[model samples]
Target: MSLSRTLTRRQTLLAGLASGVMLARPRIASAAPTEFVMGVNGGAAYRNLYNNVLRHFEARHNAKVVPVFGSGSELLNRVLAERSRPTMDCFVTFQGAWLVGKAEGVLEKVDYNKIPHIDDVHDFLKDPDGYAPFVNFGAWGIVYNKDTVRTPPRSFKALWDRAYDRKVMLGGVYHWQIHLAAFAYAWTGDQKNIDVAFDKVKELAPRLAGLYGLSSDTQSKFQQGIADIAPWYSYTAQRVRQLGVPVAFQMPEEGGFLYPSAYHAVKGTQKVELVEKLIGTFYDPELQPGLAREDGFIPSNKKTVLPAAVAAELPTMEEVQRCHHWDWALINRDEGAWLNRWNAEVRRLVRG
Candidate 1:
């Protein structure tokens, strides 16, 4: 890792932190309800967390827990569209998306009093004003076929290196690459770094074997020997390797960003306390090990121990902290325009 590069990114994050953007919470929370609904994104990690840990919470509290699964973007939009008459009490979201929703005033503030586990949560999970809180922390890494990636790309830049020509795959129509471009630019002090990153993407695009919108698609491609590498969350990378595909995951010396999926209480719901309990239960220390082991996300609660498996799958916390933090405020302010630019300029260049 380049110390100079790492320092530059930290400086940018510090500048954003100094801006004092007030912590924004969801717009409303309903009164306590007997039965509550939760929005979830599918697959094993989500299923284990919801079906196993969450079911335990329900049994203990003697309340009903309904799980509504969908794509991350779809579920978040559902919450926003139903803001006036919230159909779901709480929705799970990736930190990046959750931060965007919080800025848009779609999430409700959590009541810590009803849920004491707030105290166990790390400082990063708790907004200064106590609005959004993390349920789990996730990281992004590369997955490579052992036979194909004899010397896997060590950094994001490797994806663009001509050496891996026609052997690499990148996620498209998603925020992973977008955030990565932003991080790369922020680290290099390149105001136009996002575009630069996109240029790199275009350079490597022609050599790309495939583009995946789903984790399963990426995994299948690797298994079938169609493509050797894919950008994915650490959990997915871990699971893929376990399938005996001779896969290895990397956090890259450039460092990957930290993202946490959090519980957002929808405002104007009749399940405020129930929602709080649901959020709080995720922070329980006893539950963290199980979550980290089965789900592959770091429990947001500081008291939660990071299982060896989960820790092995992701970069060290210090390494994660080293990566450029995506200033959500800035991203929120410009993501639409940036995304539009990406679609028109970046994607067009790739297609050509």
Candidate 2:
């Protein structure tokens, strides 16, 4: 061939080869999976612990977690409000509110096949309905500052003691229902029948320093010595103590209340499989112990072996066994009515 024609043909062949290589190259994979939204209880301790787990989960699955923190009731409200166009993928709530959420049909049934680690959860903590699975548990009891209170009160009745007048604090409406039930159980031997409990709370209202709505507020009250004694969760008490507060937790002789907090996949989440995997992480035996230690929560996974310090600070198994676990289903059935009564009658009686 002529030299010019040969050169043209060679250039054409090279251009065609380059075009073919470019066409064969794969497009960069679409962006990583969208972040999952989780609604969780609000508190510095809880936020820190959840963030740690989320970071680990994100790294492993190439997914991100966006945590939405609020009180259990507030989170439940958010889930219900957004039900038609669900924004949150998963929810973590205390038992009372979890039951309410379940009753409201805002949660999806847990698919055990997708979350195999759930098989390792303690049978007692499992949800019979398979909707919400318990992740951790904590006890509710009297929390007092050792330096301020010369003698620690030993029973729920102590709130009514004349000495504690205007020196006690109680959690707000929904949260304090557990305390009210405790008094009813102590006074009538029945948590479900709280008529007497209402009267008891009314009597003690005059003595209460105030009704605190946020955990942070409760903690601040105790830290500032504005409140001397109050009803509080043991896990939270431990967290406060770790902060160098002089707080101490005591289970009233009438018995303490134990509540199991759980995780539920919000119905209509597009990330069902990913949500299941995230829930499974909560039950990972290896991870549960560390989370339990950090948050002062009792791990739900039976295989979790907590470190010595964590175990020592947590309630003994026997103590937990003896603690009263409210029939949240029954409570949920009438929770709204109870809250109405509390707002109308009980809350109005708060001294200030």
Candidate 3:
């Protein structure tokens, strides 16, 4: 099945499950409640964390959460389509998509008064204008099998080495922009110019074992020893390691990419109070560490203390300082033109 069809099927299945839960509950005397539909990433790791939060919110507020899962872009499209009569009460997406939602005026400005927990979040993680506030973040860096690569790679340049030919796996086209930005900075000391990055990627194409569109594909490659190294978010790397895959994560010496997962209230949502409660629950210091532990995310709640092991696995403050934060607004604006250039120039040059 096509990816879209597969995602639609998954969403249907999950929605059915949510419906079942609602039906199973016995009706009791209480005020009429609202059903808050949240759009979130359709990945197992993300669902695990969100589900936990959902359970707690449901119990406390007596409201049902109907989760709609899809890719960030896909969810954004849904929000736009439903702008006349929005269905999604809130959206959980990455920084780039959040910017797009803000630019499109599909997101509601967050009101801090409703979510007192907002004060506990580190200032860096808070959206200055409060359109989308980051709940958790993870660093993007290199993942490698320790058994295969005795010498750990400390830089993005390692992916270009001829010695690892046909042993490297890269993220698919959609994710290449981040890699391109990293390469642009590493090669030309300019993150905005992609010319250098494109040339470098074309050079490394012959060495690539494969390009993965999903986390499962990347994990399978590592499991089968078909790939020795790849680029991925720290949460994924941590999950793979937990599965005893002989994998290790390294923040490249040049630095890494900081990818923040944020939440936005849909512009026309009627459950503003409920949405605030959900967002508050997501960033609650009591729940933040557990959510972070589920996926190795760095909690944006400054007061949430992580376990020693979880803390060790995350990017240190110094490492975070070295990481690159893209001009997402600019990238989102030019994404189409960039994708066109990539397909016509870089992708066509790939070997096999």
Candidate 4:
């Protein structure tokens, strides 16, 4: 992961393909278009992404993409369940789920050479073990109702204050780990301390509104006034604002946390070429900028630049570097024990 080495290699590989896309070998016009399946979370934002950014990739590859949309865990289970003969060719998900997939034998150790984007991506975003390369990420932090809370919150400690009683909400399952990691780091100076998180969730339970199961649930609660403040990613915050709720997001005192998404070929699938093509589409300098403009995501491709106005609204590269790093592999290993403890102590106590 040396910067000097990456730069030297990038210069050599990018020299020959400077003018055009480094694409998969061209598909024959007479052959039936290959149908490639991609797993994604189903929702309006994802649907918009498919229509705007992904469709072009499909066209260029002469492939018909069939997206199988579900939550991160659901998609992981689907691939694991279908491991013998994978109906899905590519698996796309967040870090936590990817960790599980890697441990459970559902994912392959990706060939970095096959994924041309690996060189263009920020060094931190590429998996050193080569499971997958992160395509994009959004910083997760405090999202609060502007009307109720006149001032912006500065720390994770703010969520536990009696000031927001019966008003706090946090995102989907994987988000539970993000929330846990933040408080764990704040209290113990260790993000891997799930024990601290378990204690904090219980301590915050009297005030806890809900542990949301989906982004839609958070949007609905924010719209209906059931949640006054919570932890959410930039995109989910935007959706809450679209619901006509006056919500604002901030990088908290503890700093924003990183939750990234990546796509890799399923272990037993025969669509490696198409999967590599999809990853190349993510790294394409010309096309990668659209994801930032359309979805507020921070692209992994270093060459992808955001418009001045759009860049102003999103977290800067400096802020992205300072965001808290997640120990997803540890979380995935302890998830079973943590969930059991959470249900025993924290779940039944949540009011919403």
Candidate 5:
């Protein structure tokens, strides 16, 4: 399908109301309420964490939490669509989504005084104005079926190798592709250096099995023996293992990109106190540690202790610290141009 046609259809259904939408009116209350809603990534384990740890606070405060599960983008666009109506009280998303939301004026500054745990969080995670605070760090790399490919690809170069032609795959529709493209460019020390990145991809074109639409597609393809390698999030590596799939997740020797998910209060949300309470709950040492253990994300607050097994398996703080960082702000500021150029160049290489 044509790109414009696809976007127009998405816009009509999901692009959300333009900036012209009126602001929502905050609900008034004499004191803290007993009920608040939170939007989070959809998953059973995450839901369990909220029910076991965070809900304890709500019970202590005589309040209740309602969770609306979605991806970061889904939550952001939903909040944006309901800008005038304010359907969500607190929205949890990645740093990129939160920054974009803050820039769009859809988020409200969190009062640091209210969330005492703010003091425990690392400086890099907290926004100056407190509009959104990061919850955890995540890395991007390759996930492959260990049983299928004995000599796994060590780096991005392996994905393009002639030996693996028509056996490689990647999650192309989601943000992993964005991060991979960004990483490819960043590795060249040229954020806008599409030519180099495209050259790399073109070299791998002969090995391309197909582009996938979802993370599950990558996992599924690998399990069915359709793909030999797929680029994915570090967290997914653990989840894939839990599913009884013998998968090997690798961080390229050249280093991979990392991103963080954040929590933000929607502007004019009625339950400000409730939102603050929920955000504060996220930083609770007790909760943060469990989140890290269960979700496979590095905790935002350094105080949270990860399980020994999990810590041993995942990348260390020092290792994460050593990798080069991609400038997410620049990417957010110019994603359209980058994607456009990426598409054109990739198509040129593929068409050849």
Candidate 6:
């Protein structure tokens, strides 16, 4: 419980207060279908959210799901900014962002019994605290242009090589978690020591091509040959290649971090049971593996059985162990300062 980071974001809340007041209605008088907005990551993965997850839930519940998509960080800002009355009933976003939302007091816990399929989740991925229900995961590592570099990057450390000068696209300010994990792993062998990580970032500053905030932006950079490499997630790498970009992913020998995708209810949302149930739809054993085949991420459900082709392609969870797993509470406490340091010391030095 760090002091709430969202208390000062009242300006954003004020701006939306009038609209929320006008639209916030009691579901008392009717049995009409409920309409709720879901905030999620934008870009290629929208396919899985729509085709595999959303539509089915909507059909069964007679509800209308409107999706508001953005990068995980952007969605986090929205959750905190609208703390008193969130416009999005629930957000399907990343673990670190969810940690911040929970700390900021904008997130609501799901009653485990309410989400039926939650029991199907692997014990290792379940959140004992109940705020973030991580449904999918992917490997975060280096992705390189296969056409230009015949030698696939074998280590995260390769990003700093002089040969990659002005040819690397790193995550933007919003993606502070990955940038920290990357630089720390590159220099200090783990993500816990920020002092060492900051030093590594300053050293790599000279070689950066630019910073990107979205999957679409990353794909365009690789496709147009604007950058030949980036520290990115495997699911994003797979989506980029599917769009005709020639790239390949590798979990460096030191290991890569896990990108866990989670969904949590907004504190003031009127549709509590509905929101949790919708999230539960993603856990259906038959639908969970589609996260692997279609969205390019590993499923979190213990009962999910991936097809042979997908099983062969994805890296084993064991491959992601070199770095220390991130702890949610500590991350919430330190994330803001990390972003501030990145902007002041690292972002200012790099040129696109």
Point to the candidate with the largest TM-score: 3
Candidate 6 lDDT score relative to the true structure: 0.77
The whole-model C-alpha lDDT of candidate 2 against the native structure comes to: 0.79
Per-model C-alpha RMSD: 18.3, 4.7, 12.0, 12.4, 14.7, 13.0
The C-alpha lDDT values of all candidates are: 0.69, 0.79, 0.79, 0.77, 0.69, 0.77
lDDT of 4 by residue, 73-99 (tens): 788899989988788888778888887
> Which runs in model 4 stand beyond 4 Å of their true positions?
1-31, 171-174, 239-245
Error of 4 at 285 (Å): 2.9
Q: Residue by residue across 154-249, what tens digits does model 1's lDDT show?
A: 876677777877777676676544444544563475434666665656566677876666777777888888788766676666655556667776
lDDT (C-alpha) at residue 141 in model 3:
90
Give residue 187's lDDT in candidate 4 (0 to 100): 75
CA shift at 170, candidate 5, in angstroms?
A: 2.2
Off by over 4 Å in 2: 1-34
| Candidate 2 lDDT over residue span 147-186, tens digit each | 9998888888877889888888888844766766777898
Q: Write the per-residue lDDT of candidate 6 for residues 149-226, one digit (tens) a residue.
A: 777668878777788888888888556666776667567765678788788878888678888767787888888888
TM-score attained by model 1:
0.81
Clashes of each: 10, 0, 0, 0, 4, 0
lDDT, residue 32, model 4: 68
When summed lDDT is taken over every stretch of 10 residues in candidate 3, the lowest stretch is: 25-34
Measured against the true structure, the TM-scores of the candidates, in listed sequence, are: 0.81, 0.85, 0.86, 0.85, 0.80, 0.82
For residue 137, give model 2's deviation from the true position in Å. 1.3
Worst 10 residues of 2 by lDDT: 25-34
